[model samples]
Target: MDMNASPVPKAVVVGAGPVGCLSAIALANLGWHVTVYERRSDLRAGTHHLLAPNTENNPRQRSINLTLSARGIAAVQAIDSALVERLLHNAVPLRGRMVHHLEGNTTRQQYDRGGHCLYSIERGLLNLILLKAAAVVKNIDIQFRHKVQSVDFNKNTLHLCNLVSGQELDDHFDLCIGADGSHSVIRHHLMLATQMEYSQHYLSHEYVEIRLPQGVDSSGHEAYLLDPDHLHVWPRGSFTVVAMPNKNKTFTSALFAPKSLFDTLQYPDTLIPFFKTHFPDLLSLLGEKRLVLELQSNPRSQLITTKANPYHKGAVIIIGDAAHSMVPFYGQGLNCALEDVRILSILLRKEKDGHDPSVILRVLNHYSETRHEDLVAICDLAMDSHLKMRHSVATWSYMIRAFIDNILYAISESPSLVDLSETIFGPQVPSWSWLPLYSMVSFRPDISYSAAKKKAERQERLIDSLGVAVGTLGLGYIIYSFINLNRLF
Candidate 1:
């Protein structure tokens, strides 16, 4: 399989999540006969998965609301510009981070000098669009309720068991993609096949979904408890709560807490008192009775962060959550997975021996090596932000430094900071060598995402010091001139 020269082959993608659906979309566009196997039923069935409150108070309601920042939008735009625009309709553009203090005083920090908004959207809606797009492609077929049980990478074949009927079958493909997520069967098979170093850590934090109702405001468009145009974050330090609005006048809220805190929550009786005390006025719209019931009934989702040394074998490759799973605090989980679809398509089209499974493995290894640093950085940031969200604003020292940092972002995001903002928002610049942070985060044309991040950080330090030096020099010159005038007089 010389990757430098062949046509598209039969590709198998496991998982029907956003990442998996996007992979199927990309592969089909690249002219491959792509098949996607998912364990869940089709999302387009429109069966309301959300049991929380809605405008109609209809118990059957739903939303997978997520903060879709520039990086995510860029990735989506790269794949299909129209889909990006279509998704924007359901999204509320957030101009900046709206920090909600316990006292009710708020601060708005813009992300871009031009006031660029990070779109917030429903996750399930995005998945449906991707799935529908894949359905339209003649090269793809999506099989729901088909669970992949195992893979024999050596033989270029996969073993799958039907999730519904308990029927087992074996199939072969030129390339197999494990976009199945953290507990990917493909990733598991790859680990057993070769010498792969894998590490997984379950963080101390936990997340449980909460609800906020939608009501008509004084003006009459749908009204929400929190501002709809912004991403609402209640940073409390040890724990935090955030909300993203949906089309239904209601807002989907999540509570992130330490295991200890969640474990202590048992009955509805204690739940309301605690929420009202901790979150204060937030419970006004969300009623104490409902909050307590949700805390007791809703499951607390665990956070699992992981990394795999190499992502490929003779016929298999793992992408999305399978390759690197991080916490959802950053809201990049689904978007990052979609980005993988784009990257994979680029690689498949470029590889000369496109049909050869062996070549695919080599490419997969290169992809893993290149992506490692960025994945690690995001995972760590997600973990650290828990502290930032819950407590940093409360500390004067931390708040001051953060304010300065925000100012820097405002400058960097400026068009005057053209090269700077582009780098800050993502990794796509070609010429301007950015500091590691800039490079990894935004300017990534030349270097790998990891190396770029390193450069962006180093650049930030020098840039900050340069400002200080110029200010000091100006002050010194003014003082010297005044002394000379005084002496002359």
Candidate 2:
């Protein structure tokens, strides 16, 4: 039985977001018949169609800009380097974070040494590009405005409703993938089919969007009011505001605060003063009138962290936010989701060589087993980062430790030092090769999230021991100097 002569498996992908589109492209590349179903109309039809104007009644139109790191870029590149390059052309590279403090004081924290950067891109635009790429594939079919109402995993059939024509339809496939985000219909049916462990936890904080229009520089050319090369953050003790630049020269900003805070600022009188007291520097960039309008108009969206075990069962598999929806602090949610497609694609390709369609069950099981730990690791990291971004970024101790970690990273990168260390300390010191937690998570595509977390824990312990040793030596030296001075006197 030659597997090469076997017919390609038909795959149904729910949702037309970036993850779904990427999955379709990957499946098509792997010689699968792919069909993508999207509930919303095609977004690439008109200019600013996705970017709905800030209205008094509706506010959840456009999402915060996506920060694309090495993990995501690697995933896209794996599918098509040309597609990745096209996406990068519209991205604004962000090297680090610019922390804005009270009294107009600002501090810059670089994410990595040696010029590593993350790209900021409009989410809608990126989705459009991905959909376009998927559309061109001969083996892929994209159906817009078709909502999946229910799924029967045992039967391998989908109950879908056409939003445009108001017609219900049934679609059958060899495999059904749910990338329909946190509230997924496929995930719901999977829960009914099997005992799937799932949990959704929401943070007390909620966020609202604020748009910062482009301004003119001294030369009368368009320029960014804030540093365009860095993600701008105004971190308050209990809340924070972040802004990311777009190619259109505007910055999409979000104000994250407690629900109680949002409740109090329902009117202009309270909202205007709140911004004045907490984020005074933003007044010039986002004028008082515009800020008030956006605040009053924009909906306050909650921050949620969702986790599910056994992302696949039978012929139905869940990926992206449907599997593990996380807070956006670590900026790895989308990256991890994209990586899911890449990994699953690899597994399916490997299984296809067996020429047995039943091998998909084993492949999906393997995927769920292996991908769970990394998903959990990243979810934990994202939750922890909320505190680090809002409060820890302002502390001197955090900065000092970051500096020390970076120095060690620089040393590890030196070929001579690495060679000498390997010769002296041998394999025992291989684990000591300095890689900061941020670098491991954001910059290194080779390391899995779980492995990175474990390595970080070990490095943290080493740093703690080194800190204690250095403190003790300083104290001993001071005591010796004092004793000698007393004898002289």
What RMSD does each model have against the real structure? Answer: 6.2, 4.8
lDDT of 1 by residue, 1-489 (tens): 788965657888987777787778777766789889877666577553233211123433333476665556666665667777777887777665677778877876444443456677676676777778777888888887787777887677888888788999998898888887787878888899879889999978888878677777788867776777777778887888888777776777888889998877777666777777778767877777778766666667777888887787776888888988877765667656666666666666677766665677777776777766767776676666556667774567655555555565555542222221123233444434332232133322233345545555665677679778989999999999999999999
Candidate 1 similarity to native, TM-score: 0.83
Lowest-scoring 10 consecutive residues by lDDT in candidate 2? Answer: 417-426
User: Which candidate has the top score in TM-score?
Assistant: 2
| lDDT, candidates in the order shown | 0.69, 0.84
Worst 10 residues of 1 by lDDT: 414-423
Predicted candidate 2 versus true structure: per-residue lDDT over 340-454, tens digit per residue: 8878876776653522548888888888998899999999999999998899998899999999999999989522222210121112225648889999889876677888799
| Alpha-carbon lDDT of model 2 | 0.84
Clashes in candidate 2: how many?
Answer: 0
In model 1, where do residues sit more than 4 Å from their true spots? Answer: 1-8, 46-64, 219-221, 393-399, 406-452, 459-489
For model 2, what is the error of residue 266's alpha carbon versus the real structure, in angstroms, after optimal superposition?
1.5
